[model samples]
Target chain A: MGNCYTFKIKNNFPELELLCAEINEIARESNFSEQLLFSLNVCLEEMLTNIIKYGYDDNRPHDIEIRLEIDNEIMILTIIDDGHAFNPLEADAPDMKSDLQHRQLGGIGIFLTCKMADKLSYERKDNKNFLKILLAPHVAAL
Target chain B: MKLTQLESTDRITNLLLSGSLDISGVKDVEMDFARLASGKRAVVVDFSGVTFIASLGMRMLLSAAKKLDSEGGRLILHSVPPLVETALETAGLTMVLPVVKDAPDAISLSQLQR
Candidate 1:
């Protein structure tokens, strides 16, 4: 059986620190290498930041759920949010060739998250956005 | 996260940053970072103590680099940990933001640009 951990936070941006701390603790206990931990941290922060920043249109508070299941060398991360129905996989990739003068800032978050993870899938159900990410051991080796 | 501003010369401004540069870490230093980068000839950020970095942190650096570039200044990063360097490389930011080996190298690189 795999180990499972879940974290729930408000839509507020400040809550990201808490989420990161929890993940860090779990990753350490699981003996994750620094590189793997960094990738996982980046993926979590990027996805959660996107949801918190652009997922909602109102000021009302909402809950975001993150679940992690670790089995052997594979990790499955599931993030569920009650915000807008947005599929990150469908977002346009950033122009990597742009020079410093023309380079865009914000779009790189989702791109980096996608590149670091092994598999990414998105689904919208009952007005909630579900994002599933898989990180295999081989991807972490990079 | 802690941000310490080193001595500023006529051509280069040094900022030593230590800690996680995630969302909160970026927030703690974004304003100060911007304030220091503004109108400066060159900026060297010593990343020896930075343990982690994320997209938010990368965005902060990129924004600062773009701002410096537009103002005829440059931003250089040195002493970056392997993990942080990999993250920057993965995002292809190393092409724009120059990452060097040490503080002296960063200073020299910035000076050469001027």
Candidate 2:
């Protein structure tokens, strides 16, 4: 058993900065390494940004929920948004091999989130999108 | 976020960037970065001060790199911290943009492409 933390923010782009600051404080208190911290930050920012940008069709405010739980050496992150039915796992991976001339920028965020997290799962229930991510400390090569 | 434009000479413009290159950070310097990078033969960005980077920031750099590439110029980055460097590498940006050890090396790499 470990500690769990939950944070809620409005579906606004500017709110991301505040959320990131809170996460940073928590990461420091938990003694998270810089690499792990950076990975978590990237994953959260990409997911929330997508929700705020394209989740809603109406111009109304909404609440996005983020929950973090740390058990043993692994961390679990859950994000819940009352947005449209979009599954990130199904998103196409960016063509990383493509040169600059042909590369597309739109898909890199989701691609990065998929690549950085050790495990990712997505579900939609009652018009809410749920995304779960698991991260583990990197073990150096022997 | 802070962006300092070093004095340009020898056809290579140097820009020192520090702080998180997230959405707000990118908003703070994208226009200025564009202005400084425009029409330059080569640009060397010092990434030692950059603490974190997101996809939006990557887009900004990629857009600038592509612009420079189209103009027959090059963009070189150096002194990146390991975490940020990993993010760039994961995105496969090291293929398009050259990452070196230091500013001098970055400048020399950009110069050689000319």
Candidate 3:
């Protein structure tokens, strides 16, 4: 048995603030560690920001659905969007060895999200982009 | 987000940032932060109060740092929460923007001959 929460947000940036606020509350109530909270926020912010920034082709607004589930010791975050079939897993990893002057911040969002979240998988089906991220605690809580 | 700056010396500028540097937080302070960092002095940011950061925050910091770098100045962050520091490190930002233990360590590093 587990708990699941769903959120529907517009394909815009401002909506994320409300979404994160509610998420932070539930995550704290569920005993998510501070580290876990940070990681969750990073993943949400980065992924959704990417989708909002580059996911659409037309000027009209769109809808993005987010599902957060807590199953025992694991946290699963699933984002479903109706944007183009872009797979974040295949996005180019940014150059981590470059000097400051040579560095470009383009690809770091998804790359850092991948590093923070324990597991990530992406798929395109039924004309929707499904991106799932799994987060496990670094240490079992007492 | 809240940004506070200390009385700066001729060689050092100290700023303390509090709250999440997420989307809205970045919007709340990016302009002020950029203006404060646009100096030739070493800019040391106290990051102990920041509870969250994402790539947008990173971009804000990077733009300011890049601008400061072009002007021969630098940005240093200290007292970062562990996981936040890890996120920065994962993106290889801590190299260009050094994260030290405390304000003193950051200050000392800023004093070192470049």
In terms of DockQ, the best-performing candidate is 3
lDDT of 2 by residue, B64-87 (tens): 888988888878899999989988
Q: First chain TM-score in every candidate?
A: 0.93, 0.90, 0.93
Worst 10 residues of 2 chain A by lDDT: A133-142
Candidate 2 colliding pairs: none
lDDT of 1 by residue, A67-124 (tens): 9998777788899999988999999877677888787766788888888788899999
Q: Which stretches in model 1 have alpha-carbon errors above 4 Å?
A: A139-142
TM-score of chain B of 3: 0.96
Kindly report which residue stretches of model 3 are placed more than 4 angstroms away from their true locations once superposed. Answer: A138-142
Tens digits of per-residue lDDT, candidate 2, A1-142, equal 8999999999997787889888878877888777778888889889999999999988899999999997666778899999889999999878788888777677789988988888889999988999998888654211
What DockQ does model 2 achieve? 0.77
* Residue A24 alpha-carbon offset, candidate 3, angstroms: 1.4
